[model samples]
Target: MSRPHILAVAKLVPLLLDQLHTAYVVHDRVHEASPEEFAKVASNIRAIVGGGESKVTRALMNQLLALELISIMGVGYAGVDVAAAVERDVPVTHTPGVLNDEVADLAIGLMLSIARRIPQADQYVRAGRWGKEGAMPLTRKVSGARLGIVGLGRIGQAIAKRAEAFGMSIAYTARSAKPDLTHTYYPTATALAEQVDFLIVITPGGAETRHLINAEVLAALGSKGYLINVARGSVVDEAALVEALKDGVIAGAALDVFEKEPHPSEALWTMDNVVLTPHIASATWQTRQAMADLAAGNLHAHFAGEKLLSPVPECN
Candidate 1:
């Protein structure tokens, strides 16, 4: 049997599949297989898919479908047109299990950083501002803080596990309650935010959640709450957030994701109370490699007539 053709669209994490001797299929390029290129390896082409959702759209998707399966590697297949793929009878897969611990670690880190003003303090001391300052709002105690989790998925559970070490009281708002968890459940997000010293968003991104953490929610937390988002940037209102941080509507925020990709509002740049990082909550080397391997495992299973390892049944 001939080798199954695979195209790695995700630019950040390279495919580490040892089972297949593969070549790179750069999606940004206009042609991975042109007339001359196709003529050389036309018969060898089988499957093609990009890393991010938009990476493989109309033409690329159609070409990949004409052959065999087009497997996607990451949990967010916001790129794969599942309805279209289903209509075309193409099997789609993603890597879901690997990044949980990494994301959870980031959640805890961001929460602690925001609560303690770690990043700002670092900047102040490095810039010699501490020499003239009265008292640089030192780190806060995580031991007795109230922790609010926005989503109660696997990553949320992982974060909760980490919080146990800090001796935090956990409270969460899930669409549906998990009977197994002894953690307190609040009927509304406002209730959760109201009760916690820190609010950590672990929810998924999309329209339903767009601007979920807005002025009203921030106001509900009062001036003592800290917001940490390891989720999507769109989940919170960036403009409102800037104003909140500036006016002290909320104590502070620790963000791993932002409204704009690679660009946050300039107004948020210098706030001593805020801690902002590029969207890298799940970017650990070990975790990303595991994700890649798991994605490949799904593809390997699918072609071998085995069950798919992780499949997104429907988008929520």
Candidate 2:
């Protein structure tokens, strides 16, 4: 029997790519194929695979007459048109939980990096300004500070756990209160920002959450506070953040994700009060391998007539 045809819409890691090739006849990036070429194979494709940032639109799904599953190699599936997939009776699975620790670790890391000016200090020493200009200015302390998390999901909970170790007071804002947790809950992001010294965003992205953290929230954070974003960039208004940073509406910011990824606003490039990372919250080798394995496992399970390992909440 011929192997099932798999369409890769995004740039997948080599490990996952190799595994897919071994089990199926993989068409790497069929979205990039010529119109005629894509038409020839579209109906035969049985599955779709992509990374976190991949775009799987309704049009693409409409072309796949036999698409049974979509396996995403990352936790965030904001780019996938999940409603369209569900309407088509296709289930979407993503690798979650596996990378919770990694993302949480990066959140804490970014908080420290920004609050203490670690990156700036390193630059100062590298430029020999530290020796020439005398002692560097004192930075904020993380321990015993108030922390407000924008989301209280698994990753957010992990971050809160770490903050507790630093003796930080933790609070959060979610769609609604989580009754089991003892931490303080706020009804809105602005309210949470006003009460915390460091505000970390770890919420999901989409129209409902787009620009959830806006000028009001940043202003509430105040000039003495800081912003740390380890969530989707759309969750925060990038333009507002830029303006706030420029006006010192907030003390500083550390961001891993941006509205325009791999190409954040040029203005952010020169800001000394900001620390930026290339959306690598789950980029570690071990975590990536685990993600790849889970993604491939979902595909394998679907093809084998078994239950999926981690279907997205929407699909469930």
Candidate 3:
């Protein structure tokens, strides 16, 4: 039998690419191929694979008549047209649990980096300002602070667990309250923001949650509160966040993801209070390797007639 043809839509890690290439005939970025070129191999493609941020639009899926599964190497699949996949009876799978700890670790790290001004302090020392300028300015404390989490999913719960070690009083706002947990639950983001010292966004990204954190929520967080986002960039309004940071509507922001990605607002670059990362929450070698295994495992299982390892929530 011929090896199954798979389409890769995003730039994936070499480990995953190696695994896919070893087991299947893979086409890299067929979406960018000319129409005539795409038509040549589209009919033979049986699967699609990409990173979390890959765009698997309906138009692309429509071209692959043989597409059976979409294996996303990252936890977030907001860019994938899941609704259209469901309509076409194509299951979407993502590497989720493997990344929870890595992302949670980054969230806590960012919290400390921003609140304690760790990055700035490093710069202060590197520039030899600590000796000449006297001691650096005192920064906020993270221990025993009030924390509000938007979205109490597995990753959110992981972040909460980490915050607990710091003695943070945790509250959360989700689609609905999680009755099993003892933490306080607010009905809305604004309500949660009003009472917390740090508002961390971990919600899923999509149309439903686009700009869930806007000017009002930032206002509710107040000038003394901080914002940390380890979720999708679209979940928070970038424009409002820029204005808030500039105007001191909130104390500071530490972001792993951004609205445009690889490019955030130019206004944020010079702000001492804002700490930005190039979306490296799950970038660790161990976590990324695990994710690669899971993503490839899904494809292997599907072809082998075994059950999928981790289908996205909608598909499950």
Candidate 4:
């Protein structure tokens, strides 16, 4: 029996590559395949494996006449064309729940890193300026501070749980109030920002959430407040965030994800007040391995004619 052909839209970890090789003929970088070579094998390709950053467009899917499943290695599937997949009755699966803790942990870490100026303080010590500059300027505290969370879903609740251990008070804003919860709910992001010392965004990225935290919300947060985003970068207005930082509309920001990604605005790089990460919120070895396993499992399930392990909400 011939192995099923799989198109790899994004690079996979070595372990997953080994696992996939055993049962499938993996085509690495189908996007860059030679036209003749791609044409020869395109119709035989039955599955596509990609990450959150990979583009799974309708046009691309249209090329793979035999495509049955699109599997994503991460929680966010904003880049995948789910509607297009649904139109063809092709299911899209992603690894969720597995990375919730890692993301929540990073959100809290970013809050403390920005609030206490941990990165700056480390730089101060490394430059031997601690003695010369004297005690690295007093920074704010985190314990017992008010924390307002935007999008109080699983990860948001995880963050709130972690923040509670630090004695931080919690309030949140979502599309609607979640029943059975005790935290205060604000209908608007601006209203929530106005009341908290730290405003953390963990909302999904899409049309409805794009720029949910706009200039008005930043202004409401005020200069004493800090912003930490572990969610989609589009959730916050990047240009407005830059302006707010320049004008001291908000004290500072620590971001794990950015609007442009790998190349966030050059303006943010020069600002010592901001802490930026290269979208590694769920990049831990264990978490990444688990996500890879789940993604691979979805592909295996699809080929085995069994139920998918983690189908996206669109398919479910």
Candidate 5:
């Protein structure tokens, strides 16, 4: 039998690509194909593989007449138009649990980076400023501080568990209170921010959560508090965050993701109180490989007439 033709929206890890090559004829990238070439093979494309940020727009999916699935290599799939996929009876799968620990680890890392001024201290030492200018200024303590988690989902819970090791008091704000959770619950983000020394954002990204952490939340966090975002960038208002950091509305912020990726706001780049990473919370080798395995397994399962390993909940 002929191999299924699949479109690769973004180049995946070599290991996953090797596995995919064994069962499918993979096209390199959608945009790379010539107009006539794409049209010729569009109807035969059975699936698409992408990272969390890949765009599987309605226009693109409409071209794939036989598109059976979209396999996302990471936990976040906000880039994929889930509504469009559901309308066409196509299911979407994402590697969720595999990267939870890595993301959570980064969340805690960001919290420490901000509160303790690790990045700034390192830069100070590297520049020989420590030798010339005496001791760096003291920074806030991380241990035993109040921690407010903005979204207590899987990754959020993981962050909470890690925070416990530091003896931090934990509180949370979610869409609705979780019955099993014993931590203090706040109905609103502003309410949660008001009482915590650190407010970590580990929420999912979507229209509902866009700018959920805005000026009001930042103001509530106060000048003594810090913000850590290991979740989607859109979940926090970048403009508000910049203003807060500049105006001392909040003490500092450490962010793994940004509203504009690979192009975070220029204002944040020079700010000493802010730390920025290029959306690499789940960039560790082990976690990325596990995520790749799960994503590939989901695609393989779909083609083999078996249950998908990790279909996004919305698909169900």
Candidate 6:
């Protein structure tokens, strides 16, 4: 059998190199790359192993016409250009279902962190700022609070189940309503925002959901409510969110993902109410290894003349 050519854009920190070695996976385990190094791949490489949120731009797709396939290593495919891929007959695959628990866990944690001011309080302790001068504002409870989820996909369901354990009632708005959930289903994001004490965004990030949680929805969540976004930052408007947070339009926010990764706005930095972390919703050692293995499995399938396990839908 001819050896397959696979190019991975990012590194896999948690996955076992030995296991992947035996399976004939050629990967770049070191994620940090200089721009010049990436440019080489941008110019030469054919196939790509990228995050589900990483796009195969028009230029890259042109390059891949001569390559094998692009295997996305995560569940989110907002970065992948499905339209262009189809135009070129290039198959795209995503890591779905497996990362649900990890991402949902992050969502739930962010909800708790913002509501309880966990990150702020931790910083206070670490920086010798706790009880430095005055008493801090009392934190809120995640348990017994109402949670509204924007999208109820696999991760949303997983979050709902986790929230239930914390005594949270789950209400959500989806493309089509889910009638089975005991928790109420709202028809719109606006309605969901108005009802819940905490709003957790588990929706996909794309043109459809871009800025879905805008100033109006922020207003609907009310001054006492908190927002937790473990999804994409594009789903929330940064300027409006900073304004709302500054004025306490909503109580606080906790975010793991951002509209512009590696650099979030300077506005959010001054706000004591917001908790920000680099996008690490799927950063758990075990979970990430699973994702890589699954992505690698998808690539193996395509190269072996078999069907891809998790190909992104042609419609999406």
Per-residue accuracy of model 1 over 42-103 as CA lDDT, tens digit each: 34455554453335555555655344555565666665667766666776676776888889
Tens digit of per-residue lDDT, candidate 4, span 1-316: 8999999988788757888999999998856867778888899999899888788999989999999999999888888989999999999999999999999999999999998889888888999997886877788999999999999988999999999999998999999998889999999999999999999999988778999999999999999999999998889999999999999999999999888878899999989889988998998999989998999999899899999999999999
Span of 10 residues, lowest total lDDT, candidate 3: 29-38
TM-scores of the models, in the given order?
0.85, 0.98, 0.98, 0.97, 0.97, 0.87
- Tens-place lDDT per residue, model 5, 1-316, is 8999999998788868988999999987955657778888899999999998888999999989899999999888988999999999999999998888999998998888888889999999999999999998889999999999999999999999999999999999999999898999999999999999999998889889999999999999999999999888899999999999999999999999899888899999999999888888988889888987998899889999999999899987
TM-score attained by model 4: 0.97
The Cα error of candidate 1 at residue 179, in Å, is 1.4
Q: Alpha-carbon error at 138 in model 5, in Å?
A: 0.8
Local lDDT at 271 for model 1? 83
Poorest 10 consecutive residues of model 1 by lDDT? 24-33
In candidate 3 the C-alpha lDDT for residue 53 amounts to 85
Show the colliding residue pairs in model 1.
9-50, 9-51, 10-51, 53-79
Residues 1-316 of candidate 3 have per-residue lDDT tens digits of 7899999998878989999999999988866866677789999999999998899999999999999999999888988999999999999999989999999999999999999999999999999998898999899999999999999999999999999999999999999999899999999999999999999899999889999999999999999999999999999999999999999999999999999989998999999999999999999999989999999999999999999999999999
Error of 5 at 289 (Å): 0.5
Q: What is the lDDT of residue 1 in candidate 6?
A: 50
TM-score of 3: 0.98
Better of 2 and 5 by lDDT: 2
Tell me the whole-model lDDT of each prediction, alpha carbons only: 0.75, 0.95, 0.94, 0.92, 0.92, 0.79
Residue 149 in candidate 5, Cα distance off native in Å: 0.5
Please write out the lDDT profile of model 6 over residues 1-316, one tens digit for every residue. Answer: 5444455665544363344455543536222355455444444444667775665677656654455577788777877778887777778888888889989988888888888888788777888766575656788977888999999988999999999898887899988887677768888899999999999998998999999999999999999999989878899998899899988899998888888878999888878888888998988888888887888788778767897888887734
lDDT of 6: 0.79
Ranking by lDDT: 2, 3, 5, 4, 6, 1
Alpha-carbon RMSD to native, per candidate: 3.4, 0.9, 0.9, 1.2, 1.1, 3.6
